[model samples]
Structures are given as structure tokens and as C-alpha cells.
Target: MKRLWLIAAICTGAVLLAFAQTQQGSPTPQTFLLRYKGKPGDVSRYKSWFVMRMVGTMPTPAGLREGKMEYQSEATYLHKIISVAEDGTLEIETVKESGKARMGDGERMRDLPDRPYKRVVKMTNRGKVIESREFEDGEEEQESEEEVAEFPIASRRYQPTYWLDKLYETAVHNIAFPEQAIKVGDSWQEKVSEQMTPNCKVPITINSRFKELVKLDGKLCAVIQSEIDAPIDGQDNVGEWTVAVKGRFNALMTIYFDPELGDEVQAIDEARLVLEITLSGPNRPTLTITHRLISRGKTAKLD
Candidate 1:
């Protein structure tokens, strides 16, 4: 009986030791909560580049006219944290540095200057833009209605102030992050609305998923995948013509974000748009436009 008790005691001790080891080896699941952590006076800079290609066929009284358009642009964005409230709301001033765009067939429309622009914006820690200003440019002259009416659609879209506003709007809308703590494989949705023109409003829906946590460039980062769908609605006056767009817009984006740094390290986005544009004015006809756009960017601390 004594020998049996000794063996039983040994077995119990072995089991307890094994259980303790298992408990020590097992790791707790990791939870990530994303929030901006910039303090007053902190600054960051990002280099962004994009290429867009558009092809369209329009029916004219003569026949079908087909055209291809392409443009590429690069710009630098600088963000300065002006203040941080106790509730984690941030007031930031953003500046767009000098930029250049190349457009038209064979890039003949080259060396187009992008005027520097600035804006002050307030945002929450969860990446919600509370308020934003109309960007100001040094070279922007107040155009009369007559002058605006004579501008082409392309010129209106590529105007320095207009481009800057669009970029800022895109950045604000792209911050579709999960509010609560999330683990890998968690998903969320964010809704974004934008004014494509004075009278046209577009609603965009974003589906975001946390794909994985991995090390990128020696820094731990979270890899996120997002899908975007937007539909255009309403009618707007573009230059000399009244235009309406009907179509589906879709995009796929991947972002590598560093939680500790409170910034995106790198990102890639691709989109395809099929649009039916109805134009009415002097001698315009309905047209179909298809566009493909790709953009990439990287961010770093301004030291």
C-alpha cells in the first residue's frame, strides 16, 4: 500500500507540473485598439502618387468618338498637430507642398503646376473628421462666373484648389477604422459621403477587415484590407455643361498601419469606375466613361 501511494503521489505531481507548464506557455490573445496619438507640435509627412486612366466613347451626330486620357501626379502632404484636447480630439493643420501633374496623350500636357494649399481640420481620435476648412492657395484667383463657365471639365477637375480639396476629402473619408478593440479577423463598416459637385452627392460604403498582425520594415504593423463601393447620384453643372453620372464604383485597398506610431506605414489602392454621363448644353450628347485609378503612398515622421 505504501508503494502504491508513493506512485500515485508522483503521478499527481507530474500532472500538476505539466499543467503549470502548459499554462505558462500559452499566450493570451492580442487585442488592438487604433487611435491617433499625436501631441501638440508633432508633425508627419507623406509622399503620395497617383495615376489615372480614362477612356470614353461619345455618340455624336457624325458617329462615335472615342478618346483616351491619362494623368499622373505626385504630391507631399504635411500634417502638424496644433492641439490635442483632453478627450483625444485633435486640431491639425495640413499643408500640401509643391506638386506636378502630367496629363494627355503621350504625356504632352506635362509640367502642370500644383499650387501649394493649406487647411485646418479638427478630428477625433477614432479618425473622424469633425470640421475642415476650404483649402487656400496662394495662386488661386477668384474666378468670375463667366470665366468658370468657359473652363473645360478637365480644367475644372484639375484646378489646384479643387485637387487639394479632393485629396483632403479622400484622406478624411479613408479613415474608416474600428472604434472598439479588435482582434485579427475582426471586420467593420464605415459610411462616407462626398459632394462630387455642387449639386451631386456620392455615398460610399467601406468594408474593412483586420487581416493579420505582421512585422513590416522591422516594425510591428497591422495589415488591413478594405473594399469600397460608391454610387453617384444627382446632377451637377461642370464647366459649361450640365452633367449627371450613373455608375458603379469599386475599389480594393490594403494598408499597413503601425499602432504604436499611430500612422499608416504604407498603403495601396486600386479602383475601377464605369460611368454613364448625360451631358446637356450647346451641342453635347450622352457619353460613357470608364476609368481606372491606382494610388500608392508612404508616410514618415517629419524630423
Candidate 2:
């Protein structure tokens, strides 16, 4: 729908404007060390909302046609510090508290069946996942669009290393910072490779910058910006359909981190992507899909 595109456009513009305003020419000489230093038994409750709109054009038997799909959800999670290693690494266990989702077509949101999905992650103080494990406590719910949206962060059971970003890295501006003091205007880069499937490996570089300091809820928060522009295209053959796809995933992420508390206060992520697929053996039909997602999360700590 045109409305979805308009909303995406507006959000994209807002991201650019907000980042531009934080570009102070040459920040001061002072610096701060940012780390994840939660003690064992520390708990954090995070509440967030995810909205995604998909618009596409597909070739049907009749002719070329347009298609649209959208998903929106509100979810909650509880992250508890399981253990802290002597080397500053940590084991954190995250549990899905509740989730509610509905179709984007004016459908009212409803609760996802009451269930608890759990994940335990091991990472250094810089928020890089060294290991991740996901498990559910009960029987799997029937798969559906709403179910997929319910656990957008990590898979229910098996999880690849790259998928671990949804739990930690994205909340911290996608950076695995060096053990060094960082100042405003300082930037870092991390090269990452993600395995989408058994045969598909996508590689990307994440760019992060300490933009500036800001005040939120009367707390001085450090603003960090992250960006990802990666191309993920491949060819596949399934049953009698040969598919060739091309796409780029572009995302803009902003993090509001509390330096004194050594934790995050809020995070925002906006991603827009377009993919073109050509299917052979079926009159060489082509499809073009555009996807836009906006996510916002806030955190509260409980000891």
C-alpha cells in the first residue's frame, strides 16, 4: 500500500536527520569506557514493538500482479544475568515473557498463546555473542504468520551465530567494541559473516560511531549509531523452479546507552530492503518485493 511506503519514507528521513544533527565537528578530548558489567542475578525487562510492511509484484498465471503483506507485533522479554566469568565474559539467559501480534490490515492485535521460549547466550563485555542456545519449555505452536512475528529476534530452537545479534548486538549499536576508551565522534567497524542457509553465507561489515551524548529521562545517555548495507543474492533450484535473487539489506540503528550505569536505555532500528527474483521454467516470471521494518525497544533494570 502507498500508505506503508509513505510511512517508511518518513521514518527513513527521520533517521537521516537525527543522525545528521549529532554530527558535531571534532568532539572534546574526554572519553568513556562502555561495557556490559551486570552482576549475577541482575535482571532487565525489555519492551519493544516491531512493524514490518511488505509490498511486491508477482507473476501469476493470469498475468503480472501486485501483492502485499504486513506484520506488526508488541513483545516483552526478561534478561537475567546467569553468571559472570572471571575474564569479564557473561552468560545471560533471556526468556520471552509475552507476545501479541496481528496482521497489518487493520486487524486487532491478539495474544500469542501463553508459552515461554528461552535462550542462553555467552558473550564478552563488548556484547559479542560467543555462543547461543535456544530452547522452548513446551510443545511447539502451529506455525503461522503471527507465530513467526512472535519470536522475531531468535529462532525457537536452533540458532546460528549471526542470528544472535537480535538478542545483544543490535541493542548495543551492533558493535563489539575494543577494550579501549571511546570518545564522542569515535567509530569502529566489525566484519561479520552470516549463514542464512546451508549453502548461503552472507558477509557484511557493521559501522558504528559514538555520535554524541544526550539526556533521556533526566539521565545522560551516550548516543551510538550503527549502519549495515549488505548485498545478499543467490541462485537456487527447488523442485522444478529455478530461482535467482538479488537484494541488499540496508539498516540504520541508533542506541541510547547509559555510560554511568554501563547499560542500554533504548534502541531504534529501521531497515528497508528490496529484492528481485526471477523464476525460470515458469515463463521466466519475475517478482519484486520491498520490505520495511521499524523497531523500538526500551529497557528497565531490576536487581
C-alpha local distance difference test of each model: 0.58, 0.55
- Expressed as tens digits, the lDDT of each residue in 121-240 for candidate 2 is 777776666776767666545544344334322233112112223322432323566567777899988877665533445567788888999998877788888787666666655445
Instruction: List where candidate 2 sits over 4 angstroms from the true fold.
Output: 1-28, 107-114, 137-174, 282-303
Model 2, position 113: C-alpha lDDT score: 48
User: Cα lDDT for residue 111, model 1?
Assistant: 63
Model 1, span 28-82: residue lDDT tens:
5577766665678876666656666666666667977777766667666666789
What count of clashes does model 2 give?
0
Give the range where candidate 1 is weakest over 10 consecutive residues by summed lDDT.
10-19
How much RMSD separates candidate 2 from the native structure? Answer: 9.3
lDDT of 2 at 188: 88
Q: What is the C-alpha RMSD of each candidate to the true structure, in Å?
A: 15.8, 9.3
How many steric overlaps are in each model, in order? 0, 0
Error of 1 at 115 (Å): 2.0
